[model samples]
Target chain A: MNLTLKVWRQSGPDDEGRLVRYEIEDVSPDMSFLEMLDVLNERLILAGDDPVAFDHDCREGICGMCSMMIDGVAHGPQKNTTTCQLHMRHYKDGDTIVIEPWRARPFPVVKDLVVDRSAFDRIIQAGGFISVPAGSAPDAHAMPVPKVDADDAFDAATCIGCGACVAACPNGSASLFTAAKITHLGLLPQGQPERGSRARAMVEQMDEEGFGGCTNTGECTAVCPKGIPLDTIARMNADYLRASRKSG
Target chain B: MTATIDRGKATEPVTQIPSRPRRSRRRVSSNSLKAVMAVSGAVLVLFLVLHMAGNLKIFAGAESFNGYAAWLREVGYPLLPHRGLLTLLEAGLVVAIAAHMYSAIVLARRAANARPVKYAAKVKSRADGYATRTMRWGGVIVFFFVIYHLLDMTFGVANPEGHEATPFDRMVAGFDPSRWYITVFYVISVVMVGLHLRHGLWSALQTLGLARRYPVLKASAAGLSALLTLGFLVVPLAITFGVVR
Candidate 1:
């Protein structure tokens, strides 16, 4: 299939970006979206032009590094699938694909189709971890965790940090992302020691990162490549309130 | 042709970017505000019911009605003392209204900015319930009505024709003959208020994380809307029908 690509191109973080057009023909249906882009880059190189830069590692969709806003929807039209897993077959021949980096105040564009997602890292660094001391690995079955609680914790642990939720959100809120982390650790026995402070610290960090407040629009869940549920956010809120109240 | 051949001959290793695990933080500020709205609204509804019931004393003639009013004034508005409790309740009401309005405005703004595509079709299907659909608009209308009501009742503002003064006199004048247009308008406004409270209550609960499952949330939302609508409408209809005079 032949497709026209409108790809965002930027020189650096400080530079303004614009969509530049490129045409690629003879794309195979089986080729993953990234592979097709690889073909286009090969063509660009032959023509003495710079190849389009995008972030991707594992094309298996678990990495969340392959972030792109295709046609205004985060991760394209596919539900619960990342961009790297999306294939050329999703588009018709001669389809004009508009590809751009994630749009958010925190995630600034670094180059073509690649934005610096370090703001998320900073938020995590602020307090998204369990404060366990360094020690020998414990037996796997030592701590007895309820099946239901473990299941909920596992569900919350699936966040991939792609910033797709923020890009999809109108206010660019990071509630879904932050909530998942808070709930995942807060549910475990190991996390109980610092759960209260952790919730407070993470919430304060989230606000400090300048992410907008959650409006319960459910768009985060809709665009989440991992299908992280919005209920996780509710859990985080309850935890935060409890933590803050106790501290107060 | 030479450039293409040279480009094909060149080789570079592909570097892999590591996948970073994202920590999801779901803030329940909106939900918390909704909870506040729901609880406060329920309290307000209770107050309104008792108020209407007290006003029903008019049906027993002037002595009973005025006596009830005098007793209320003398009691210094029990459940809200004239000085301390009244001040506290008034302050709390102001906070609740501010929070509710602030959260609603913010949510509305976010919703307005979130739509990525504009549909060209003339007919659009709405997935939201009737209450959710009209929340912002309904809230605005009710807000304006509340202001007008306070002015009319509390400050002894003249009626549309500038005839009546004092809340007691206005209440008697407004209900004695019960003008058809006034009755219709009052009924409609009260119905809107009911609609607003109904959905607002359930949604507030959901926001507070009380309703986790969608089915549970949906059912509660619908039930609350229906109950508030029915509960609020009963007294107004009674007055309009001369059942409560």
Candidate 2:
């Protein structure tokens, strides 16, 4: 299938960018969206043009590295699917696809279709993990966690640290991501020690990262590749309030 | 020794001042109105449920419905003083309505400003039903309806001659089976209100920090929406069926 691609082109973080149109012909309907982009890049290389730079690794969609806002939606038309997993069959022969980087203040455009998602890393680093001592392992039965609690924790743990929630959010808030991390760790007995501090620190880091607040529009869940529910956000909010009150 | 013993020791009482209650009021933030909307909407859902249950008295007979309305008015008016409990309740409702409106406007404005580019082609969903989509519009319509209801029922302003109605009478007359237009409008508007209340109630709780647990919060939100929608719908249906008259 032939498709018209209007992709954002930027030299660097400091460079002003614009939508540059390129027509790719004889594309296979079975080709992945990224593969089609690769075809475009190969043609660009042959034509003595700069190949469009995008972030991708483990193109199987587990890494969350392949990021693009295809025609405004995070990861294209399909719900809860990553960009790499999206196929050209979703579009028609003459469809014009608008490809751009994730638009969030925290996630700045490093280049075309690639935004810096390090802010998410910093937030996770602040207090997203349990400080388990390095050893062989703990006895699995020692904690004796209820089945319900274990299941809930598992649900919360599915967050892929993708910035899609931030991209999809109107406020550009990382509450969903932050909440997922907080809830996952805070639910277990091992996480009890730093639960309060973790919530406070993580939320502060998120705020410092310049992400916006959660408006409960539920768009994040709608677009989440991992299908991380928005309920984690409520938990995070509760934890944050408790932590702040205790410190205050 | 006697002179030394004569030396007197005097102690003074240290006066500890009571701290004044902190006078600082938390200014409404950008999300504050949303918070207010969420909280008040939840409370209003409770009120609506109770109200519908009370209106179910209409099923017993006209005497029962009219009696209930009369009882409410009497209890709210003459039985109480000029500044009474009912007055305070009415005042609270007004405040809740004002807060709900203010927050809604603020949120709508923010949402509008945030979307820099609107989609050329948007997919509409059944889950994202018409009532859900037109929440803001529904709110405006409901606001107007409330005003009209208050005028026609409470203050008795411009009561049409044929519809010489009390609050209960007005409700019954509005949903008269033959008056299809009125019934249709009532049903549609109430459904809109239900849809608004369904999400609005649970969202209010979430915003107010009550729904902190996962799944439970989400469930409550969904449950509240469903319950409120059902609760609000029953009254109009009952009236239309002549079960409430």
Candidate 3:
């Protein structure tokens, strides 16, 4: 399939960016979205022009490193599919696809489609983990986590931290991402020791990182490639309130 | 061209926390504000439902409707001052409204700061963006509408039909279809309220942590909001149509 691509080109973080159009030929329907971009880059190089830049790794989608806005939707028009995994078949011959970076103050554009997502790192740094003894691992069955609790924890742990939630959010809020982390830890008995501090610390970090507060617009979950449920946000709210009250 | 894979950076990744973790300090998290917003929203929802039920007395004829209106002012009887209960409720309402507006403004400012750069092109990711996009402007309209409603029906200033008249007669005259401008304003306000309530009800449930267990609660929120909106509008529509005149 032949396609026209309108891609955002920014030289650096402080640079003024603009959409540059490129028409490519001999595209394969079976090619993944990244592969099609690879083809475009190859053509650009042959013509001595700069190739379009985007972020991706482990193209299988687990890494969550592949972050780009395809058309309007984060990842792509396909629901629950990452950019690396999005296929060219979703588009038809002569179709036009708009590609751009995740637009957010916290995720500044580094070059083109690559925005600095390190703010997410700082939030996780504040609190998103469990602390245990520095010895041999305990017997997995000794603590006996309830099936329901374990299941809930595991479900929240599935968040890929792809920044799609932030990108897709109308307010650019990272509540879904922060909530997923809080829910993942707070649900586990292993996570109980630091639960109060964890909620307080993470939420504060999220606000400091400049992410917007959750207004329950429901877009974050809609664009989530991992299907991170919106309820994680509710659980985060519950935990934060409890923790703040306890601390106070 | 060789594939320029977004390599795993030597600087550790985020979202997926590593084996080693760091300690953190806490401030009054935004969640505190969210809780306030949720509680205030719930208060407003309860008030709307009650107000809607009170308004429906218009259908019961002049005597009952007027009696109910008068009963509201003297609810606590001789033990408490006349209109004392109503005054107390109004005081509570003022607090709730203030908190709601404050939280909304602060959060909106924070959201804007979060993403300093706007998307170069317009991106409406989903089909249902109308509610989210309209929330702020709709809120502004609703706020002004509430003020105008008080002037029209409470303060006896803006009511062309005369608020000094008995409650039933005032409502009947105010909503008479011949006065299309007033009816138009009333309809716009209610529709905006309906849209606001639709999103607000569900959003409040999530913020208060009431929505985690049952998915059906979303449907209930929508249904309840729609019912309340329709209930509130019935009086004006009926009066305009000459059904209750």
Candidate 4:
């Protein structure tokens, strides 16, 4: 397949970025989207031109490291598939693909297609953890979590911290991502003690990060590569409300 | 494989992640503001339902409609001053509207600030329904329409028959066939209300954490908004078409 690629390029965090077009010929349909980018980068390197820089660690899609907006859709058009997992067969010959970095105030562009997602790490640091003793492992099955709670926690745990929710949200809200972390920890027995403080602290941190409030638009869930449910947001709201009341 | 992966230093104690000190806070959190919006919106919705029901009294003839309007003022007459309950209700509505508008302005501004740079390609989504997209602008239109509606009906300033006229006369004169423009504006504004209410009702449910548990809330939101739109439309449309005097 022959294709036209319009990729965003920026020299630094403060540099003005714009889409730069490149045409490639004889592309394979079997190549993953990133692999095709690798091909493009190889050619640019051979010609002594600067190579495009994008963040990707585990191309298997679980690492949540690969972040790019393909045609204004987070990750790509393929539902529940990250940019690294999206294959070229989804496209055809003579197709034009426009790729750009995540556009959000909280997620600033570090370079070409590489936005700093440290805001997410900061949110996690705010509360996304349990208070476990450091000395030794606890006895097996000591804190037997309910099956239903375990299942729900597992579902919320699938969030890969990709920041796609913020990128795709019309409000650029991080509610879905923040709520996923809150839900994953809040549902278990061990998480019960710090539950109230966790909800309050994490939500406060999220707001301080300059992410917008959730309006229940569901665009974030629609574009989420991990398929994080919107229900987590409701749960987060409920928890926050309860926490606020108790704290007051 | 010349890639260098820095997985934090192995000797660094992973016991506890350093947590930031809590900042001094006075501003209301976004979640709390959302609850305020939801509660206030819900109050306004209930008021609309009662108002629509009251308007339906017109079909019973002018006497019944006027009598119903008079009775509203006389509510709790012996126990309280004339129009006391009505005034209290109006005061509550003003509070609701104020809270709702304040939250909306704050949240909308935050949403704008969240994304400094716009995407080159238009963001398309199957889930971005018409109601969801029109919320901000539709809200503005609804706000203006409410002011106009109060002038025409409650205060009688915009009505053909001014303050001294009965409620029935004001309503009839307001939507008379010759004054088709008023009816047109009324229809357009009511439709906008319906669209706004559709998304808002569901959003309120979601914010209050009820919609997730009760999936029927989504359909109910649509159905209730449509019903309210129809309920409000029938009277003006009936008057304009000469179906009601």
Candidate 5:
């Protein structure tokens, strides 16, 4: 199949970027989106030209390292699929795919389609993991966590720290990402110790990061790669309120 | 001992200075903005319901309608000043309106600021829904309508016979079929308000942490918004069709 690519290109963080189009011939339908990009990069490199820059690691979709805004949608046209996992078969021979990086103020682009996601890291650092002493691992069955709680926690825990929630959100709010982490830890018995502090600290960090507040538009969850539930935000609000009262 | 002897203010960061608790530091977090919206929106909904009920009195004829309008001003006789109770209520409503609009504008500005760059391609998603998209524009229309409504009804400048006319006469003159533009404007603005309230109420409840466990509250919010819309609209239609006249 033959196709065209309209990829965003910028030399550095300060440089103005534009969509540079390239026509490719004899494209295979079975190739992954990233693989097609790799082919384009090889051609550019052979022609002594600058290649398009993007982020990807563990292309099978587990690491959440890949990021792209495909055709105005996060992770392309597929639902619950990562950019790296998206195959080119979904596209037509004459399709002109548009790829962009996450455009939030907090997530500045490091290169073409590669943003500095350290803001997400800082949010997690604020209060994502439980503080457990490093000696012995606890027995899994000893806790006796209810199945419903376990299921919900697992669902929340599936968030891969992809910035798709930020990219997809109309308000560009990180509430979903923040809430997913909050719910994941807040649901477990082991996480009860610092639950109050966790919610307050993380939400404060999120606000400090300059991400817009959620308006419950639900676009974040709808385009979420992990299919993180929107109700995690409700969970976050409940936790934050409880924490504020306790502080008072 | 020598190394430890340099304990002085110069080594400290500016933020490390000890100070009193900062109460004002809690100025409208996202959740707090949402709380403000919910509280203010609740007041506005109350006003709409009461206003609709008052307008419905036109069906009872001039004496009933005019008496109801006049009675609002003379609510507390010797215990309060003239128009005292109504003035107090109006003052509260003004405060609620101010808070609601301010939060909405700030939230919208922040949302815009968060994304400096926009998508190059058109994003088509019906899943985003009609209310989410039209909220800002709908609000603007409603705000303008409120101004026009006050001029026509309360202050009497826009009405045909002026504020001196009986409440019944003003209602009839304002929504007369001959003045189709005013009627059309009223219809458009009220429908926009209905749409705004439908989304706004659900969002307010969700923001206030009430809709998570019970999904039925969302339905109720929609129903109430629709009811208020029809309540307000029926008066204008009735006037235009000569049902109330």
Candidate 6:
């Protein structure tokens, strides 16, 4: 398929970025979106031009490293599919695809379509884990995690830590991602020991990072590849409220 | 292989642990401020519901409508002084509105700061419905309308019948058939409020963590906002059409 690609290009972190158009032909319909970008970069390198730089790994979508806004929608027009998984067949001949990096203060553009997502790591560092001593694995039957709690935890755990939620949110809020991490642990019996502090610490860190507050728009979940429900945000709010009341 | 794995684990460097996580020392967290907005918005919604019901009394004629208005000022008359209860309620509403406005300004600024650079080709998701997009501007319109409404009905300043007129006279003259522009502005403002309430009610439920458990609150939010808006609109329409005059 012959297509027109308008991709964002930036020299560095402090440079002004602009969408540079590229015309490419002979693209296979079976190729993934990232594969098509690879072809473009290969051609650019052969032509002695600077190749477009983007973040991607695992090409299979679970790595959460692939981040780009395809024609404005995160991950592309396909629902529940990351950019790496989006195939070229979704487009037709003579189509013009406008690609850009995630736009959010917490996720600044490093260069081209690559944005720094270390803000997510900082939020996780604040408290996205259960406190456990390293030793032989505990007996499965000894813990006795209820089926429902385990199921809920697994559901929340499905978040891949992609910045799509922030990219998609009008407020550029990281609430959905923060809430997902909070819910993943807040539901388990093992997570109860420091649940209050965990909620307080992570939420404070999320705020300190200059991320916007959630307005319950559900845009983040609508574009979420894992389909994390908006209820996780409510759970986060519940936990935060409980923690605040106790602290008071 | 197991021994090698254990050896690797033994050689792993132990990272330094940070100090214990501190409790929230900030006077107000983000969600807490949102809760304040939600609670205050909920109070305003309740007041609107009651106000709509009172307006509906116009169908019973001027005597009944004016009497109800008089009773508002007469309640706890000897104990609390004339219009004392009404004054207290007005003061409470003012405080609620002030809190709501304060939170909105701060949160809007934070939202702006969160995305300093705008998306070049951003598209609105399906979930970002019309009501959601119009919230900020709709809120401003509602704020202005409330001031105009106070001058026209409560203060009797903008009423055609002047300040000496009875409550019913002021309301009737406010929406006289000849003054169709006022009625049009009233309709537009009321609809804006309805739109604001539609999104605000559901957003409030989410912030308060109620919608997650009762997902049905989303539908109730829409239904209640529509009902209250219709109730408020009926009185003005009735007066303008000479049905209640």
Candidate 4 backbone clash number = 0
* Candidate number that wins on TM-score, 2 or 5: 5
Tally clashing residue pairs in candidate 5: 0
Query: Model 6: residues >4 Å from true position, as ranges?
Result: B1-27, B213-215
lDDT of 1 by residue, A112-217 (tens): 8887787778778877556665598877898899999999999888889998888777567788898898889989998898887877787767665556666555
- List the pairs of residues colliding in candidate 5: none
Error of 3 at A216 (Å): 0.8
**Candidates in descending lDDT order:** 4, 6, 5, 3, 2, 1
TM-score of chain B of each: 0.65, 0.70, 0.86, 0.89, 0.86, 0.87
Please list the Cα RMSD from the true structure of every candidate, rounded to 1 decimal place. 7.4, 14.9, 5.0, 4.0, 7.2, 4.5
Candidate 5 lDDT, A91-125, residue by residue in tens:
88898888888889888877788888878888899
Candidate 4 CAPRI category: medium
- Which candidate would rank higher by lDDT, 2 or 4? 4
The sequence of per-residue lDDT tens digits that candidate 6 reaches over residues A1-248 is 99999999998887998999999999999999999999999999999999999999898978899988988899999999999999999999999999999998888788899888878888899995677765889776987888988998999899998889999998899999999999899899788988988988888888877789888888999889888889899888888888888997
User: Which has the greatest DockQ?
Assistant: 4
How does each model score on TM-score? Answer: 0.73, 0.75, 0.92, 0.94, 0.90, 0.93
Give the whole-model CA lDDT for all candidates, comma-separated. Answer: 0.71, 0.73, 0.84, 0.91, 0.85, 0.88
Lowest summed lDDT over 10 consecutive residues: which window, candidate 3 chain B? B14-23
Ranking by DockQ: 4, 6, 3, 5, 1, 2
Instruction: Select the stronger candidate by lDDT from 2 and 3.
Output: 3
* Model 6 pairs whose backbones collide: none
The lDDT of model 1 is: 0.71
Off by over 4 Å in 2: A9-19, A77-80, A89-96, A125-155, A170-173, A200-217, A244-248, B1-36, B59-62, B73-83, B105-132, B161-165, B172-184, B201-245
Interface RMSD of 1: 7.0
DockQ of each model vs. true complex? 0.15, 0.07, 0.46, 0.53, 0.33, 0.48
Candidate 3: tens digits of C-alpha lDDT, residues B1-245:
79876666765564331222333554345677878888998899899988999899988899989999999999979988999999999999999999999988888887887777787667765634566678888998999999988987887577766757998888887887888688889988998988888788888878877685545876776788789889988889999989889
Q: Tens-digit lDDT track for model 4 on B37-80?
A: 99999999999999999999999999999999999999888998
Q: What is the DockQ score of candidate 4, to 2 decimals?
A: 0.53
